[model samples]
Target chain A: MFFNISRYLGRFKLVGCVVRNFLILLVGLVFSVNALANPNLGLPPLNIPADNPQTAEKIALGKRLFNDKHFSADGTISCASCHQEDKAFTDGLPVAVGINGQAGTRNTPTLINAAFFETLFLDGRASSLEAQVLGPMLNPIEHGLQDQQVIVDLIRQDRSYTEAFRKAFAIKVDEINISHVTKAIASFERTLISGDSLFDRHLFGRDHTALSSSAERGLTIFKNKGNCVTCHEISWNNALFTDNRFYNIGVGFKQLTPVLDKFIAFVRQGNNPDYFPLTAVQRSELGRFNVTKNLADIGKFKTPTLRNIALTAPYMHDGSMKTLEEVIDHYDIGGDQNRFIDSKIFPLHLTTQEKQDLVAFMQALTSSKSPNHPTGE
Target chain B: MFFNISRYLGRFKLVGCVVRNFLILLVGLVFSVNALANPNLGLPPLNIPADNPQTAEKIALGKRLFNDKHFSADGTISCASCHQEDKAFTDGLPVAVGINGQAGTRNTPTLINAAFFETLFLDGRASSLEAQVLGPMLNPIEHGLQDQQVIVDLIRQDRSYTEAFRKAFAIKVDEINISHVTKAIASFERTLISGDSLFDRHLFGRDHTALSSSAERGLTIFKNKGNCVTCHEISWNNALFTDNRFYNIGVGFKQLTPVLDKFIAFVRQGNNPDYFPLTAVQRSELGRFNVTKNLADIGKFKTPTLRNIALTAPYMHDGSMKTLEEVIDHYDIGGDQNRFIDSKIFPLHLTTQEKQDLVAFMQALTSSKSPNHPTGE
Candidate 1:
């Protein structure tokens, strides 16, 4: 009887253990799948905004809106007109040309990794991608739309768009708004993550032969003598190739020097509508000062990522330089010496071979994964 | 002869146009691919830190380190002991039990979607995951390592770990440091992104059948009468269900109120070694004030994400409540009501059915994707 009772007790104990383990296993199974990440770029997962999550339908809608020229005043140009996918989302022009052949002040910056940026535009004006899309859409010199209502009305007119909006956002046809339009565009832009470069393979993938000897030497120079790493940073694990900070590298400072005080005084007095939509020549030189209106921020522009630097031509906020060689030469001479020049800017005294190597290294930084425009047919 | 010359000119123009189009097509082809995202959770891409990019090898290494019990002083427990994968990376205990059943001050918070957080821990002391992992490793009641060097030494002693480190980081055996261990663990932790909840499907995925009618009504109460939306925010596009701010709901305030003045005065003195490793009872009551050392911040705790709330039970910073019904009841009565209670904690006066619906809605938030423990064999 004692033996029978002990066996029953043992069976009960076994049952308890089994149930406990099963519960744990069940819990583990409930939270199992891994999220997506860009390991090739050594990039962490993208920090998607809580308000505007990505959906296949929304991304498709955004691409349509981005390429649609109807949003423009004369229906002559679109966002794709300036941010062409061919030249790493840049127009490859010295300055952006809008409808009617009208040129904008600043160069059209690459939208390659704009999703990772803290602030948008060269001057660091807009804070979010959602906020940044509206600036160009409503800018008098760009898309030239009068107000946000016009964008909403234009989107509302299209039957296909209304259906697409309904599918993506689950909102009624009448409820379609400007924020919805920008949200779609921003979602599409976030998908433009460029990684899997030759450089990434050499470093992250542990492939020694991925980079050429010249490029390897250039990488050393970039981190050391060139001092380019101060602005175009490459972290120990990943390389965004940008510190995301503003600096006056003395580009376009020459033209602004004479009229500096007057511009500063005018900007200090808020609500100066006349100061805005400045002539292309004057706007090019205002740099970050245009956004912050701070005298200290004058001539300072955001450090552009060097990730597909080889494809983008006419570098700098003004798109002054035509080639990488010209940019290096400018840096070699400690930039165009101006009072607001960044402290890190100094004469590098690099040799011809070193300069060529630097260019080679930058060329290797181009991603193997190109940004595809999924028409979403 | 004039007609022939005109035809030749037309042919030349056609050839030029073809060449231009081909070049544009080639550029477009060179930059064409999309990055990854977590839309099911209404989450943007994860904002990976540049210094600790994710790698499969590194994530594997981190999993090994996280599960290894040898790092602890007594070799009885590991990080996994408390942050079990089954319970949404949390221990269901009222407060964390460390080496030799040493109870900690605060509850074991869930590691699910920790990668989305700006500040870590209930007190919001640690800034980065890399930095936060070190706290438990060295804490007397937790992993109980003497210093960072001990962790480095422990890993070095393991030949398999040394080999894995070489593969993951491309560093020599001797170069293995505590930072690398933390980086690997943090990378693994970042992958624990819990989304695809029924709530996400109903809202972001446009699946009307995802939630019951009662749960749907609960969502309305959560947003309107409950005033939960003021803190547990759900944006139009996505829902993190948290504003990522701190507030006091008076959970452990009763135990803290009498000795609050004494504790505040002692904390203000600063640099008091005796004050540290406060008894679990005392520690649980400090809340946000422990980190900020400010009177205004006393008894406040971070607003936890409700993404996987159904799985992580015994709610709040102290883990006082045992069920969803109890949690709703506490909120309905405007929480425990203390001197430091948040103004938003006014009486909700929710009906019994409304309370049940809220619980039902929360249960619907259980993510379909569970946090898997990839052993990396």
Candidate 2:
């Protein structure tokens, strides 16, 4: 699933720096099940909204629609474009490329355990999966759709979709609204939940042999001096590797420092934050501030799950780093001096061996049971 | 599956008539298998090229590559764009649209029983599926790639493609060539043979009740007064429903008649047939003339497979006929007067009942076994 992140960079001239926001999150599993080697433990029951309960028809229909590109303006670019099944559902680019190669600011975050996240997206602009699924389709530079009707119209064009819509939503194809479409896609995304990692086995299954010596040492460092378990929380009984909280760990925050003063002043003036004419990059760097007008939340981003950390490379909200080693190195130096940096991030003077061990431990967090596992494990 | 063919026209400002060629041929089945309901008759032994034999690994790799958009220049369209499985490999559009909404000049023919076809594409420009798979990737208006290396470079960028390529071809990632990619795709395509239609059951299994009364009457009309059996050859045994030949049915040729002399003179002066300056529409009308330099080949196109005629509509080269009724009516009028029209296409003077029966018979050509079957039977 490894793709050349650099190839995408120099292939086209910078298109005004529309960064893909790759905000990933993890919640310690919902259940305290005993099959820990099966990270399947601690997985909280999926939150199915009351209106849209899970059904086989909706999930199956959603899978088809997710892979279909006709819904896009140019009949190209589907949801699977940036969110590939392999690579833990993240396209391995520094930033995501959209319809007509519209580049965005941020990495594609893994949706492996997205079912547990409180909010959706790096900016937290969307609150639920149903709401989140349709946002990109309408974004001018994302799917480049003229209107939401583009999807509805496209869905109604094919009899298969018509039948599928009827079976899933109990509505005629033309009668299907954006809500039905998003609900179906959300159902499919819910099924992408991954569990049963090697680390989970070592911790919960009481399997002494599950973790390699290097990975075991990495796990210790992750919990102790590494300080990774705090935000990427590892509870006594479960390890989702994220506290599901927002933190500005100093990547894009430094870039926004210069723009911060004016942006905050604009927000104070009681104007809609989205009305600002910032470049996609600048808007993306706003992080949680866009969601909440609080000045203290300026550079905060959702703490992403590290469950499949090894597979999702070019890490962070901006996908600035290309490997786990680069990520560890960034954090090793406490990230580069940003004013709004989270207190959780600090310089850890780890040796080269310790870095390798930590990376190994993160690698061990990848689910072996998931079909779309990066290695196809 | 049903698509509103008329909706594409008159809905948008007519886009300069880049009609997709719809050259259909029916190959009578090569097999005489007794299990008419088995859905396996009429399928000829898959013609795996000696150079590119079928293997499980190759088929799997090809399937992935077939669905992958990365191979396209813009990372958008793939082979599946116009050849969706559900539409019997046709996109249900009158003409095929490619990347950037660039439309082509021929109806998407079904690949359901393509393994048994003698040549690939309406113009017969490609001799085999191996040759056909790569044609779209490089066509400026198709996949819109600048070079074949774009696909190769794209394939090597992903670890899954690299691993799959190695396992399928016994070649390392960097060592991969374009031939390996095409071979794999062709192998997968060879497996798209569909059979066991109600027609097959009625014909081969001696099941009189397999077809509706209307369909049975339509089958008689097809063989008798309709005169469809000549071009769409129906053998006593297998029902591939094609003679694997070329014909000019006077659809686009009537439009090209004025330009015919100039085109012929251009070819007479030793111009490359394929390099002729024509819009996608003009080039498509040239048809088999592009393959063979013979003057008689002007407007001639290969006879396409009719295994899933019902699923792939907006029938004929240029997709002029939206329904099977339109096709029957066209032959009823002996097509528009073109000097180059195939002698096989003659006016049938069919009654209203006969026309309805013919349409019903064509509908019965659909197979119930394919996963993507329109009926999902």
lDDT of each: 0.79, 0.77
lDDT of 1 by residue, B23-109 (tens): 657655653211112324566457899998888999998888889899899998899999988888888888898998898877899
Structural similarity to truth (TM-score) of each candidate:
0.47, 0.45
Residue A303 shift from truth in candidate 2, angstroms = 78
Q: For candidate 2, write residues A1-377 as lDDT tens digits.
A: 11244345435446312221111111123223335434365354467789989999999998998898877777778899888877778898999888888788877878888888888898677878898988888877678889887788777888888899999989976688888899999999988887778887777666789889999999777755565764686644456676666777788776777777787788879888788668778877878887886666777888899887777887899998888998899888878866566545667788999999998898888887666565565
Show model 2 residue runs off by greater than 4 Å. A1-377, B1-37, B265-277, B372-375
Model 2 chain B: weakest 10-residue lDDT segment is B19-28
TM-score of chain B of 2: 0.86
Contacts from the true interface found in each model, as a fraction, amount to 0.00, 0.00
Tens digits of per-residue lDDT, candidate 1, A227-273, equal: 67656866545678887778888898888777766766676676563
